[model samples]
Target: MGVRALMNDLTGSKSDKSECWMSLRAPELFRVMEKIDKEYALVRKDAQKYIEKIDFNKRMLEVVLAEATVAYQEVYKAGPLYARIPGGLPLGGPCMMKLPDTVLFFHRMKLRNDTFLRVNVLHNDMVNMVLRAHLSVYGLHLKGAYDHTTTGQVRGTLVHTPTAGELGIFLEDIKYTIEGRYRFMGDRLVIELIVSTLSIRNMALKYPNATDSDPPVRLLKKNMADFRTGLKTDLDKWVQDYFNGYLIVADLQDIPSLWKLREYDQYKTSKLAAFTDLAVARINKRILDIGGDYIRVPKFKIVAAYGLVINIYDGALRGLDTMYRRSVATTVFKRDNLRYVDAIIGFKDLEVSYRYVVNFPPGPLMPPSLTGVLRMSAKDLTAHLSLGLLMDPEVVELDINFINPPGPDDITIEGAANILMSNFKHILRYEIATIMSNSLMYGVGLLRTLPRCEPFVPGMLRNTTKLGKFNKKKTLSTSSKNSDEARSKESNYTRPQRRHGTTVKMMQDIGTK
Candidate 1:
């Protein structure tokens, strides 16, 4: 009441006091407050947009998973039997070793068998979807930060982290192709899958700014280099493991050289043998359980052989032209010391191949002789070749032809043939294992490298305003409490004032009373 009365008395009216209060507020402050409100509205709008984008990406991921599921079902229909005997052999049969009349014949048969074409189609589609999703997330992050810079908006600090579009540059214009070939050799069905041209150099070149010397760029480059190295190493290891797995067949073990190779178990070779043993056992058990009368063979003799050959064409070597000659002069080639030279140098292409073979006994519809099997008419042989063999030929030979005939100086045809004959089995095993391992790791790596989409919430982007409101409330409450405490202390310290002559009178009155 005291302050209000004093203000009214001085100003002459309550309306005058209100006018004074309004005059005291600066116009600039009101304008600044208005600008802040507008900025906040913009921030909210941006956050809403980001949320919508995330929801769209989530839907895309669901679609991708659905497609992948359908593809997996097709592949699953064949069962583990297809993986074990990739060459699409009948239920019970001896292994087909010789090269068929044409590679096309086996390829067509594989399509007709339980091995589904839809599997490959699904894989390709899934990969593309994953890649697109990763890019979309990354692009959003970049745009959000860049928008803040242009509009003078203060997004949360975490959003400002520069992504620089590294993943986009790596994946752009890159294609994933899977080529499969099926061949029958010895007691194994050779299934070969070639995944062609996975590299980032071309994409990197396209977007030079993305690979600038920034910290994020440097880190990404280092990670990619390490991944590439790991892939090559893992590919080699896979080749070894897969080869050992297929070599578990009883007939193959009879080779003296193979027996000696098996003794090198310093690197947990026992684990490889155990894995193959378990796999083979499971396949046999499944056959017996399902194909009771259909399978008349004493036992299912089948081998799944896989091979991976990564042919790396070196651009640097191409430029040097004479580097191969120089290396040959300086380096001594040892037969036992098999090492990959292409890995040390960058490769332009990678070739992968896998093979599976199944062996079954002669059946009512199938003959025991190869000649008899091949001699049957088209209609009769169709059923036999499709399900069983009409004839079992005693002698089947593999004819080798060179695409580009080698000169005598480089390597005689006879010498090349001899070398191939000596190392064919070993090479086949190594390639198969490497390809399988590489494919497995490659899929895992692709998934791992996908960028995560951060959830878009209002708090994430508009944190500054929320924090400001909290701080303002805390400041107002603390100031108000301090002012009340100060007033009380002041009142306690000051004595009550008496009238001009009341000091002496007050004492006299108190005495009289």
Candidate 2:
């Protein structure tokens, strides 16, 4: 084939341009080839250095990406958390029971907004009249329209303040029936409600005595029936939105670092380490709220459920002493669980302390009075954790049952008081163990917030393999062996002895060369 045809066949190009170029530059091509061949030896000599530099840059890029992946994972997990409210919280605050200010704030906001939605927007009176009209068509007339008085005792400062207290709502003489069920949506619990009974308060409806046979009454019933599904749907949506938007949401980004320190008292030392001059320069900014004063992340968290639920954190468990002190100072636990215990049973001056040191030696299960302190063992903490998955707490009963009824003078009642005090220790131990186990399980999978997968970076896979227990042990052993070998090599060799003048002469000879 001619050169043009041969070139086309080699490159699979369907153009006459290659043939034209070849004809015009054939001589120049030969000269260029010869020059390139002459310079090839020089280029080859520096190629190894360029290759090594490229490899170093590539490894650095991989490391940066891997670290970015880890940061992303941590930030993601810190965002959304699931909490389950436990069943049967005490009617009155008990010793050691505490809530965070932020938690109480959100809860109050939820209740206030919910009240506004039902009372102002929906108008319960109007809803009751509609129910009355619908029921009249069916020949079912009630004695009175539905209504009740709601009284709530909310003991707390304004929502922004850093104080937590109880909110007790009492509904007296309810005239309407609300049938509701709780269900889980993904990891969240939600309530679905239906108002089942017509009101007993609104008694002046115009069609109070209309029968199903009446055309107007039948038509009213039909319209109400058509909208019943839509009404229920809207109520359910509002409930879910309240939970998702306000109730269960929390900012937990500080938790990992807080847990690492194990207690709030270590915040200053940790902050100093984290925000040293060198660290500040590298990060390009100083951190605010280093003392956690203005931080609004609640140490205690709650989520809606059929029963009370809470997300227990490592910081809270470790910082029990702080909580205990605060509770005492504020008298948050001053309210009695059994109001009649003192007046009726003659039990007086009941005092209890919730302060505890975790992982402390197991010396005594209960301490003597005036030294009402108990040391919690680490082994006991872990053992109770195994029982977390097994317990599905539906109803919690808190009863200070007497091991033996207080015998007369048995203060004679001081001995009986000690027995009561000893049982309190048992209850405290059970509670602490449950909280610790739940927190540990949260780290693994009870609330696995992030996916378990290695970052898709070049070096990340190697790092993941190194993170394994066996691989870590192997690396440590190899490093120790290599270090030992290095020490032995140093010991085995000796420097040639030289006279001071000879050493000076050798140094002068080297400098001259």
Candidate 3:
């Protein structure tokens, strides 16, 4: 044979192996590999008897995603600061960033453009499609089309400037329907949804019975008695259909992040996230030993009488908070070399210089949130108008607060507020991108706008000068002195004001709100 032919023959099948004698594993070893696969087959019932490991299946999880809308709602509270609703927001642009004027203005211009698609865009689309599908399955017809088509999108503000008393009472322009979205990669359904928000308003659609001249939404709201007893049958059936189809369409390997987060939270934050990563890494090393690219992977399936489904829709975007927290911890660890050997283990000996430190709550201090909120429009085309507000919210803040202090892992309201603002960096950047993407969404020309805000400088300086008198005294003490004459600064227009209050830092807002 030629040199090339000889080389091929040498590296070929178990033939001319006089120079090489590689031993093969026995049949028993194959059984072991097969057994290794079987571990993933059985449920973890009676795990303590056979597995003898601390939550063995728990080691199989790495990351989790939560219901973004619900997560957002949990942190949402009425911001007290006077916010300037930019002209663009009222004119169909998304200015969901709710904050005081100075901060709100800056972020509205920033989050105008972004790459991370808002979860709501996916949600609205999904809800529209699935609801239509449900109606089709039920053979229901709409009396009229959405308002955006029949009547132009109301050019004026849908809501008025609300007072402090109207804090919890929002004039809901939309109504009840489970608005959420899910992505299917083959058979897995990676879904995100808001099961419930803390809000208690009925924002569901009312079907119209009148003629075209007076096109009010047709409301098929379930009888309040029926609703209180249980969801109406049609609604319940539709719910099952939506979730079942949502999950079944995706193959078993495409489970979503929202479900994972719920499951993880149920387990009380089991250390599963860490163990699964290490185990998967170990399995990969085994494949590397055999000079193969293929590695052992997870085979968790949601089997039922209908069929066996396995899904693996694992995305970190679902766990925005947990991921952010981890990111922060990682940065700190990397900066500090991740060693605690030399540091004090407890705060027993810790002494503070400040006297009488008091803690306040988190929500009222939060900057407006400006991330993840997408377009919500009541534009129904097929003779069924959207029965709710089509709000394009621009969030300016999300405050993270403690529910209960489990030892020293608690955060103050001020700390949580800072964290929320820090994470909202993406929101700011995306707003700017939105402007660049759409031509009609242009901002005030920089040349013309720059000179306009300059005059407010003198006013900002005056506020600073006034802060000195209030500094050495309590808020009530100074306010009472000028009770009648003083023009109390607007709470919403907190911009250009120096920080005040000693107890302001301790607000711990747990958003069961």
lDDT of each: 0.21, 0.22, 0.20
**If both were scored by lDDT, which would come out higher, candidate 2 or candidate 3?**
2
Summed over model 1, clashes come to 36
Candidate 3, 316: how far from true, in Å? 30
Clashes of 2: 14
Model 2 weakest lDDT span, ten residues long: 323-332
Please estimate how well model 2 matches the true structure, expressed as its whole-model Cα lDDT: 0.22
Give the per-residue lDDT digits (tens) of candidate 2, residues 1-513. Answer: 687664444332334121111111212222433343344433323332443444522332233223324453453455421122122321111111112222111111111111211111111111011111011111212121111111113321111222233332221222322322222233332332222223222211223345655433121221121112222233333433433343143222222232322222233223322222222121111011011111111122222222222222212112111100000000000111101000001112221112222222224663333322322222111100000010111111111111111111111112323345443332223333322222222111211111111111122122243324322332322343233234334334322221112211211221111
User: How much is the lDDT of residue 276 in candidate 3?
Assistant: 24
Least accurate 10 contiguous residues by lDDT in model 1: 380-389
Please report how far candidate 1 places residue 474 from its true position, in Å: 71
Q: Against the true structure, candidate 3 has what lDDT?
A: 0.20
Residue-level lDDT of model 1, residues 280-333, one tens digit each, is 232222222222101110111112222211111110101100001100000111
- Model 3 segments beyond 4 Å from truth? 1-176, 195-408, 412-513
The TM-score measured for candidate 1 stands at: 0.15
